[model samples]
Every structure is written in C-alpha cells, then in structure tokens.
Target: MSGSFSLFIVGWGIIMIVLLAIGGFFMFRKFLKRLPKEDGKSILDWEEHYLELTRHMWGEDEKQFLEELVSPVPELFRDIARQKIASKIGEVALNKKQKQITRDTIIEGYIIATPKRDHKFLIKTLKEKNIDLRPYQSLFEQA
Candidate 1:
C-alpha cells in the first residue's frame, strides 16, 4: 500500500511538471511576439547596423521641417506618432520599400493628429527611421 502511494505521488509530480512546462512555453511565445522579428532579423538588428550611418549623415539642424509642423505639443504628438508607427511597422518593416511606406504613413498620421508639433523630436525620429523626404516637401512646407 505504501509503495502504491509513493508511485501515485510521483505520477502526480510528473504531471504537474509537464503542465508547468507547457504553460511556460506558451508564455514565452507570447512574450516573443511583442518584440520585432523578421525571419530572425529584428528591428533592433537593423538599428544596430544603421544607427551609426544615420548619425553621420543627418545633422541636428536638419529638423527644420518637423520643428515647424509639430511645434505646438511635442510629447503628445510623439506618443501618438510612435503608436502609429509601431502598429504599422509590424506589418511592413521586413523590407526597405515596405518600411518606407510604414514610415510615410506614420508621419502623415502624425501631421494630421498633432495638435501642435515638436519639429525637433519629429525630425529626430524621422531620421531615426531613415525616412526619405524628397517627395513630401510640399507637406513639410505647409506646416
């Protein structure tokens, strides 16, 4: 009877361990989904490679466009803009063209949603995202 009881206890322990492992596996998967991933290449990986290049190419004074457009309320505008970018980036950030489209959409939304813009941060972020502004000169000028 005692041997049977011990076996039952071990069996229960094994089941509990298996259940815990399964739960942990699912939780880890959920956590991983929140981070950027591109077939093992992540946004972080891209930024790590490009940050230096961008810093060397763009100057602090290059924010003239965003400064004028988002000058009124910077914090709020940035938060909203980042949210927009975050949402779109997940779908389109795998390639340069798609990433550019995501950046453009986020900036366009920023222009529309900004109560008052913070050109400094806006331009900084645009540079961070490597946005190409050649086609949007008119939009920038309007701000």
Candidate 2:
C-alpha cells in the first residue's frame, strides 16, 4: 500500500509539471504575438534616407527646397508634420503650392502679408481655443 501511494504521488507531480509546461508554452507564444514587431526603421529614418537620395538625384535645388520648407517650423511642429505627411492628407494641395513659392518669395511674403503681428495674434487665439496647430504645420511649411 505504501509503495502504491508513493507511485500515485509521483505520477500526480509529473502530470502537474507537464500541464504547467504546456501552459507556459502557450503563454509565451501569446505574449510574443501581442508584442509589436520592429522592422528597425522609423518614419524619420526613412524620410531622411529618402531625402538624401532625392538630394543626390535632384542636386542642391531639392536640398534647398526641403531645407526651406522644413527649417522654419519648431522641432515639435516638424515632428507633427512628419506624421501628417505619412497620413497623406491634402497631399495634392501641398504639391501644387510648392511649385508657386520660391524660397526668397516666401520670406518676403510672410513679412508683407502679415501686419500688426497678426500672425502671432492668430496663433494665440488658436491656442486659447484649444486648437492643435501642430497638425497644420505642414500646410504652412509648404506655403
């Protein structure tokens, strides 16, 4: 009877261990599936690489164009623009506008078109209304 009881105890221990192992295996797989996969390249990284290639192909004009468009905005605004570009919102409008605005003209236009510092006032008004301008930075940058 003693030997039989010991055999039953050992068998139960073995069964519990197997069940635990199976549960752990499934849990590990589920965890892995739920985790986000990384291709390693981020949107910014891709954009930089693409811009570098464009600069190479199109020469200084393309680089200057990108610099003029991208350099005016604050870093935070630039990041928002990047995300908006990824979303493809009003892409055609921006493409059309880019052709019209020369780099020299943009600086001059901003100075001439906005008087009484109205642009600052408008920004303040928008902020007061809780409007998020970050998303719209790309639209302005293209102008």
Candidate 3:
C-alpha cells in the first residue's frame, strides 16, 4: 500500500510539473511578443512609423486590397503581420520615391518581410490566388 501511494504521489508531481511547463511556455511567448525592439521602438511605434510613411500613397482601393491579401493570417496575429508587411512595403516605396503602391511593390514587400521559413506558405498562398512566382524568383532564392 505504501509503494502504491508513493507511485501515485510521483505521478501527481509529474503532472503538476508538465502543467507548469505548459503555462510557462505560453507566458514566455506573450512576454516575447510585447518585448521592445533593440532600437527601443515599441510595436505601436513601428506600426505608426510605417503608416505615416505610406498613408499619403495608399488609396482606399489599395488599402482594401492589402487587407484582402492579409486575410490568410491567423486572426490573433493578423494585425501585427499586416503592419510588418506594410512597413516593408512602405520602406521599399520610400526608397524608390514611388508615388503610389503598385501590385509588384506589394508583392516585393511581402516577400522581403516574410521569414524564410514561411516562404513556402507564402508561395502556396500566392499560387492559390493566381499570382505568378516568376517575377519574384530572385527574392525567394535570396531568402
């Protein structure tokens, strides 16, 4: 009976440890998500910077198109992902001194902003939507 009780206690302890580990994992992810960038800019600051840089160039139609392009992102991260993509796009447009955002501009920005690990998903999404990969082959190779 004593041996059985000890085993039960051990099992409970292991379960508790696993539960704590799972909780910690989620907490750590939340903490990382809110962590400031190396340059001391908050996520909101970056978002605003991109928006300010590109606002004048974005028409209603282009804004709507961007939203549609980002629709595949999971709901929880969609806004942040959209902001990051837009930031890249804005940066590219600013560098080129482009007067407006074109489809190619959006595609190039999307490729540059997305991580290499996610390029497969990006390619799949683009293909499903009938976007050609030929124009952006170099971007994928570089990534």
The C-alpha stretches of model 1 lying farther than 4 A from their native spots are 1-103, 115-117
The number of the candidate with the highest TM-score is 3
Best by lDDT: 3
| TM-score, cand. 2 | 0.27
* lDDT tens readout by residue for model 3, 7-102: 999999999999999999978876775678998876657667877989899878778877877899999889878988998888888888999988
Model 1: per-residue Cα lDDT over 103-132, one tens digit each: 354466454333335555655656666777
Greater TM-score among 1 and 3 belongs to: 3
Task: Judge candidate 3 at residue 117 and give its lDDT.
Answer: 95
Q: Global lDDT of each model? A: 0.51, 0.47, 0.86
Candidate 2 global lDDT: 0.47
The list of candidate 3 runs beyond 4 A from truth reads: 1-47
TM-score of each: 0.28, 0.27, 0.71
What digit string (tens of lDDT, one per residue) describes model 2 on residues 18-45? 9999999977865664454487665445
